[model samples]
Target: MTSTAINFNQVAYLLITGASRGIGQRMAIETSRKFKPGSIVVLLARSASGLESTRAEILECNPHINVVTSSVDLSNASKQLLEDIIDKSLSKTPVGSFELAAIIHNVGTIGNVERKAVDMSDRQEWEEYFATNLFTVGVLNSCFLQKFRECAKKLVVNVTSKACLVPFKSMGFYCAGKAAREMYFKVLADEENDLVVLNYSPGPVDTDMTVDIQGRSNAEEIRNYFKGLRETTTILTTHQTTEKFISILEAGRFSSGDHVDYYD
Candidate 1:
């Protein structure tokens, strides 16, 4: 990941899901640079090696920052599991180390882009997708708030998409999941006066997920659209988009629960 000069607020503890690669990994490394020394960073992903690489990049940016990587699949996440992860991840930090906490709910799956809306009728498949995309996000956010209740300032971010606002061909599962996840955070922001919650759409980032959409989407137009982006070199790099995301946090002008896109 290429380093950028974006400086963020000094959060005491930060948690990032889907931190194994792409935007998540870069986000972790970049944000870790501005956190206070000795602050704890918890990274969750299914790939041990990817998490390790992310941890290494974080340490390289700020050696004093503490990074804890967990290889847990979000598809199987539970309240207890999430709570335990936070407790264990923050176990080493001293009391009253810092006053701020933040978490970015970034994990999501595209879910067989080759399947059209009608083909998404399998109950078992829907269950699995929701378990990872919707269920885990809610449980993890709740766990984070409870675990870090003492922190004076809390920020919760849901990495959302344009699909949440508009329908896309062959993206039934992804669009539904994103919409639900975005609304969940919107509700949380309305209910929780003590936290700053945001639904951030990262734009058309060039990642492995994009590659899947480009190669396997059932809609020819959708595949051609993504292919055209690559051909035109218009796809946003992970670093470029992440820089925008961090800058949004630094600006702090957006209202809580607002859906902010990179283009915005």
Candidate 2:
């Protein structure tokens, strides 16, 4: 069904991960702009300061928009910590404060995939990456669904990457984790009929992570590859990405379990 309305009453709350910077931060600000006055948005990230920055940005845009910031490190996280964050964010929320609107998995890491074979990848490093990248996505998603299943609508937006299909040289961790996440969501969508799951590729946004990729490896090919993308006109700004996502959500032309690339 082609949907194109931003009806705030339909949703009671918005939960956004990686809301500190890049596309995630922009999405939070823009979403608040569309939401009615006093709408609530919960920002989750590792850095308290980062979450605060996003909250400040949102409030600067709309002072009356209710903003909640939580800092939970996904890497090496404790399940209890995750539960606490959820409990604190929602337990005290007044009824009818905000339907759980959306859960955005915009947090990710470009692993230190230096020129090395997958077999030789450090086991500890692999665990750290998996814990945050893929594992946390599952945990947060499950928590959101369990907490807000009765809500009218719940859309799960998993931000995936081209790396899911195209493996970078020595970037096995990133590729594998994203590949797994894509399938996991596919299955989750099949199992949960009431939820909306969308795996989105934001394309080459000029974020700090993208720039770091250029210097992470000494391989000329890798450096050149990223540099090319960074310099090209194809690199999307955070605002452009926010606009695209807003359009998708507004038009309601999204489907669960499938992947959508920004360039597409």
Candidate 3:
């Protein structure tokens, strides 16, 4: 089938991490609305309650769409969650085909405090941040890329942060981790494969994480920065960001090495 022939209804599956809130939750709902009935969506989060709520919301939007929820702490790099998902895909049900159309890596973390370079004394904290943000993306990419390689259309959309491109003070660890994850896709896009990988920054949104960060010490300065960003940058609602992402995925506009900003 041609790329255009791959409609939402024909999509076999969509696996998304951190789907309980923020960009992940919005993306799940958007995918459900855009895709055809009976398309399965696997939602992963650390909160079982939140995952169930998200699944319920998606089902309400499209009852015919199959929603599966998994509560797992992605911060644990040793857990082969991605591998397990691929293994399950291989064991098809009697009713449908076994294929994953897309995988969205939206898992992430923010440090508890904004620390200066000299204040970052704990090496383990940095390691923990990398484990959650960078390592998990690598694991998922390896798993999904292998599983979907033979399929006609496969895509990986990583929801990264603007910090990957422009560094912000006190967010060194977070920036480092995000940069690493973005670079992974940068290299993977060059590999000859059926998969299309794209690293995307969703810009700033009115999310819980952003609110918490804004509540920190430099609140005034941060608020001013955001105000300036609103004037100079394109701040997207979760819905708008999700819509653009789906458009890009459906259009097959993504290449291996491109870094996409949600504002654009």
| Local accuracy of candidate 1 as per-residue lDDT tens digits, 94-169 | 4357656889999999987878888787999999999999998898988888877877678898999999999999
- Ranked by TM-score, top first: 1, 2, 3
The reply for model 2, stretches above 4 Å from the true place, is 1-11, 94-97
Q: Rate the local accuracy (lDDT) of all candidates.
A: 0.87, 0.77, 0.73
Q: Supply candidate 2's per-residue lDDT for 226.
A: 76
By summed lDDT, which 10 consecutive residues of candidate 3 come out lowest?
1-10
Q: Candidate 3, residues 6-117: lDDT per residue as tens digits?
A: 3565646788999999899998887777666657788888989988988999888888867888788888845366678656644564223534478889988877446765
Q: Assess candidate 2 and give its lDDT.
A: 0.77
As a whole number from 0 to 100, the lDDT of residue 9 in candidate 3 is: 58
Error of 1 at 33 (Å): 1.1
Model 1 spans > 4 angstroms off: 1-11, 92-95
Per-model TM against the reference: 0.95, 0.90, 0.86
TM-score of 1: 0.95
As for TM-score, the candidate ahead, 1 or 3, is: 1
